[model samples]
Target chain A: MAIEKHDKENSGGGRPVAEKGEHIVARHLIEDDNIKEEKNLVIDGVDVSGRWNTFIISRVNSEFDRSFFEEIKKTVAGSRINRCWQCGMCTASCTVTPLYRRFNPRAFIYMMQLGNLKELKKYIDVAWRCVGCYKCSQRCPKQVNPAEMMEALALVIKKYFPEEVKTKLKLDEEVKKIYEDMIIGHGRLDLAKLHTYAIQKSGRTKELLGKIERDAIFKMVKDGRAFSVLRLGKPHNWSSSKEAMENYLRKLNTIENTEAGV
Target chain B: MAIEISNRLGLANVKSDYIHTAGRKLEDIHERLLELEAKGEVKVIHIKEENKPIEAETLLGWKKKIPTNKLWHHKSCGQCGNIPGYPVSLLWFMNQMGLEYVDERNQTSCTAWNYHGSGTSNPVGLAAVAVRNWHRAYELGLFPLFHCATTFGDYKEMRNLLVENKELRDEVRRIMHKIGRELVIPEYIVHYSEWVHVMRFEIAKLKKYDLSSIIATVHPACHTYKMIPEDCIYDKDIYAGKRTAVSTGVMLALGAQVADYSTWYDCCGFGFRHILTEREASRSFVMDRKIRPMVREAHSDVCITQDTGCTTTLDKNQWIGKAMGYTEQVPVMADVMFAALACGADVFKIVQLQWHTTDWRPLCEKIGIDWKKSEEEYNAYLEELKAGGKTVNLYEYPKS
Candidate 1:
């Protein structure tokens, strides 16, 4: 079968007019992620195959949607979104930005304020990398608290982009369980148990019982310092405090569940 | 707005200038408390009874009264768990100075690690927990001095939040009532480093070794100073009052050459959650961003910090770099641990340097201590302990 070629119009005799998707000049310039092509397509009972039915999403963001801005403003972490004036001070003082340039607080705040969900979605991986170091919040010119603003961004990302978060970021359930049990169960963290469990869960059991750790344990045992951890008992009157905390947490869960219409 | 302010004040267009111009209301918390106390809105647990007071200057030039005695030690879980020497060294220093302090066993972990690392807590719940702990200290008739930077910072934030938000105070009070405790907020939430900063002169008097040959670099814990910038201590003598004075002041007082690095503002990369889940990022960050710079740029002998997480991350993560064939390494320890070492405290029994992954022998040798003899003495002491000898404890509670 012979392929049919579309006739080129003599508009200016310089370059072909990019009317359809196939005539896109300098196609290499477009990012591979943005281009969507189907092998075969049929619309209105007409067959459109290969490059004839290609679709290219525009890279330039055209709309300034404020819906996400309203959504974030309701959060305590993002309440100060209105104070930011696009000053790069927060980004400049950021500890994580120097390492991972994609995790920019100033840029993230601007995206949330303008409701640029499309652009925000692309940074779901690096967005939650803020170390909660208040260097940015300490030096923010407008007192915007870019540190807490990062928290707001994390909440938004988790809510809107659940599938992306599930795939990209590994939420270590074992580590979370250990921390929760320590905090709620005993009201104190057992470092010995945490270190052991974390190392085992990370599949680095060799490091747990390695030469360095073994020597440390031997020294601790010899000095009787290892027993000190056992002697330091629980908080005084912790059971009642535990009960109150658990009750409060249960109440909060119910309130949150009702608000979510669960 | 910032430009207009800069133009009006004839100041350079810098973020610091803007930060100064846009004044924070609760910067002078004591002053705000005076007003709030007058209205009967909040009650402050005053530091009373037998205590020594030393005045330290905060960032805003506000004089903060740091009590030197009759202190209630709030131990850090990480310090107890990972770096046993941190608290032990501080206790040894206190014993040497004959400072009266109580090592309480009833205090709870601040749980800010879980809260910040994971969004598992709300502010109200956190405020309640902090208030409960402060109330415990009040019950003991002593002012609480935090051993963890995270707890110190978290309590300071909780204080501000409880004072500013009436509903938060009510909620916390309700929680407190449920626990059969009263809502008591400390007049000042003090970190142990601040106590060390104020006692540096006294510490110098008891110094047994020459630290003049040693060059030290400081990694100020972000939670200590940066979290509540206004409340942290700063001195004109230390870095012209530009940086926090807790870590550097002690080193300078002990006569060590305090060196500066460019990445002094960078975090130790514990990043709470980053340390747990994305550990490679945390390890790489600590190695590349912090340790390498202190070693190469400053030629420092040791990296001293005040926080447990900072010390642990900076100290333990260095060995991972060696596995990747990066040879540059520096010993990291708390300010009190180094100060305790200079004071001729036991290396293994008291300071517990063996728990640390990085090598501390070279640093000790540079400070004029015979490493081999100290290790032998430590081994003999361990043998004695195993042979039914009494364990050395700096302080013991009086029998009730």
Candidate 2:
């Protein structure tokens, strides 16, 4: 009422669009994504009308996420979840936290500790943002190891919503297939092929022809990097380790299958 | 426990006889190096922080030491696999300094990579491998110096676990025994960088090329400095702190302006297998937290790291920034390579400049390294490649 009165009193044939939230004073503070503004709105005999019919969603988290905490704590990486004491040291020391506002290690720990799954649900997209820098673990006063905790978060989120994670993550199967085959075939990362393949995949083919890159390629050829690659060659007699890894994978699959069954 | 058995034999216990002291933390503690040395089990050198720039001969204990003798070299898979120059650079500097060392091919990979990457490889197998490698080193009477920071970090953690925890110790011992190698703890566990830091002054004196113009930044491998902070050699730049103690000291000694970037302490986002399973996360880590800060904030020319994983991560990920239209590049190289470069090691033969993912040519320009000479030599290798001839390696050297 006050905004409408003020806009009418001040408007000397001025535009109404400039008066964005004529109904609300703190309109500029709310994000467009969260704010619901309907023009020419009328609901159930109520004059909800226009952009003034704005609804600012509450940002405050109301619930805790303990089940998610337990889920994380059970994982080998997050076994130390009990050690966090809500000190913001992990967040302060986090490498990712500065780059991203939502990647708060301390808040995540507190939310997980208190079972604030509702709040955590909102962060599912950014949950995998942690790069596993381990700085949080090194500097954490409580040794919470938020680095691996992020890994646990990634796993639990994957487990919680498998289909969502698969679609959201969208692993480049072709890239992974090439990567795995090289590792399995050579028992090493195969830097030359890996380098070329990664550059090619990123669509930076033209960059390869640059003077700096050409020189680096020449240097590698002259230097021992190329010789070592040639010298190390492929894995000899890799059957035993291959069999062992296969067995381990099979056993792991079975366990995961049984757990999912529950 | 040894004293209780000695009491029955009327054996004279030397431990209680003397109160020897060396200035260190827990100063004047009983059974110091004097008493410990008498036991013949281990030797301890009580070093103090105030005693800066101490002689290499004065250092003692396996936690951190300066070994000026023949040492067995355990090459890291990542070092050999990712940055080819890393091991050779360290070896070249050691040779330049006339410090004797040995490398072996029969030694199996530590398998720490497999364990940390996928969690499938067992610690028992790794512990046995460590002990077996130690036994081989012991046979040659040389201490094992690991090139891989993770290996050093992992072995240290494992050694502590194997010694303190009786169950794991017995398990590892059984595995080692089955393999016909007895479990004997190494006399000293030290990363290769520690030797570089200890010998920084000597390296500075012998510097043929000044690196003061080159803006080099250091990333202390998380494993070396943080994993087991107590066992890690240096704490701070001068004396102490867990952040990263050694790399900066060597960088400064080489006369390079050490750039203190915001994320100097941040991991390169290569958490063992973390990169393999989570490339986006790893890339985000290196670029967002590490690379962006270094390039945008610090304007670093070249980044130096002590660990192989870090070198690979930073050097390789710069291409990501390049691809994304952020053309500024930070050449990542091992600190040892920088030091070797200063000592006038053949850029191609000794430092192995070719293997790095990032073109260090630009950084080389700033550091008084002639790009043209290196280019000419590289063309020679291209000639070999063009002729389809066998490249010289482990065969051309003093030994494979």
**Whole-model lDDT values for every prediction:** 0.79, 0.65
Provide per-model DockQ scores: 0.01, 0.01
lDDT of 1 by residue, A1-262 (tens): 1233333455457764443334344455656666554444443344444444444443667799987787777666788899999989988988898899698889999999998988899899898888888999999988999899987887677677867877775544356568867777788887878888888877788996789999988998899988987776779888898788666655652212122211
Docking level for model 1: incorrect
Please state the Cα-based DockQ of model 2 relative to the true two-chain complex. Answer: 0.01
Angstrom error of the Cα, residue B99, model 1: value is 1.7
Count of steric clashes across candidates, in order: 0, 14
State how far residue A241 of model 2 sits from its true place (Å): 86
Candidate 1 stretches with Cα past 4 Å from truth are: A1-262, B1-27, B388-400
Supply candidate 2's per-residue lDDT for B236: 27
> Local error of candidate 1 at A179, Å?
67
lDDT, residue A44, candidate 1 = 33
